[model samples]
Target: MAVRAEQRVDYLALDGEKSWVDFEVKVLWLVGVRGRFGSVHGMIKVDHFRSAATVEAQIDANVVSMRSKSHEEWVKSPEFFDAEHYPQILFVSDPIPLKRLQNGGEIEGTLTLRGISKPVRLNLIKPDCPGESADNCPVEAEGSIRRSDFGMSSRRGTLSDKVELSFSIATKPMNGSSAIP
Candidate 1:
């Protein structure tokens, strides 16, 4: 069955275990640094029959984690995310039209980072709605963005401008029941 507007799935209950948001960027034009936001919350409403979906998400910038302490601090600094000023990275899709494949599809949306919003297209892989519950679904998406476009122009030559983003989100009905882990 298709999910209606009233059946929107909540993402807050899926943090850490069932949901994750991560990114990667190259440093010194060679070294790859990977990082992940420790907290993320969102909602997704899909109209399966119409192949349409709406996604709204917020990522906690303050909780970003990296392999090294220095790297983590740098990412949260004014030159980058500036978590103190912009505590959240928000994303709201523009009534995405899903082109369903055998197991996955493509979804386009707008991502706002450091107060800058830009259009982004995510390649979904193995997105699925398990069982008969439209509220219980798993989604995976990957995309990329340019740091310079978002005003994150620090260490221009030392840090690569391209940032790759990937996320897995699982949702459950928000009818006072616990989400699946």
Candidate 2:
């Protein structure tokens, strides 16, 4: 169903689904030779609906505007990431079917990395707290998977077998005229 333009939607709601407050699709996680970098951007869930969803994601690995602690050398390695080859990473999820949570729910979807795509899940939450940012919401979901599944097998031993994924979302109605951007 498409929401009418007259609908007083929340700007934070991403002008899409029902996600409230609009949790900034902040950062991401990647294990390097020395440690981990959780500051990459362009591939965040941001927010979602109970039965449907739209994720905020990107595919640039040159330098993450979100994470600031990553060593310049880490971003320039073949084992960590071959920015010369795989310049883009992507993730697109189906209509998030909610599974209920203490504050929200959990939904499963597919995640694409280094050009390989695989199934993954995350938490969703609602925004009812006093914080301007996404601290708590009605929906929250998370899951784990092997990086190698997506062809991101860089530091085999230095990195863990499982990658932790997390998310929180809130809705404020939409026009339904959305296609994965």
TM-score of each: 0.79, 0.51
Q: Which ten residues in a row have the lowest lDDT in candidate 2?
A: 18-27
Worst 10 residues of 1 by lDDT: 7-16
- Over 19-111, each residue of candidate 1 has an lDDT whose tens digit, in order, gives 779999998878889999868787765555456667787888988888899989989999999999999999887766555422666777888
TM-score of 1: 0.79
Residues 52-144, candidate 2, lDDT per residue (tens digit)? Answer: 334554434554322345544555456544667776555455654333333455555666666667777665554356555442343445555
Whole-model Cα lDDT of every candidate shown, in order = 0.75, 0.45
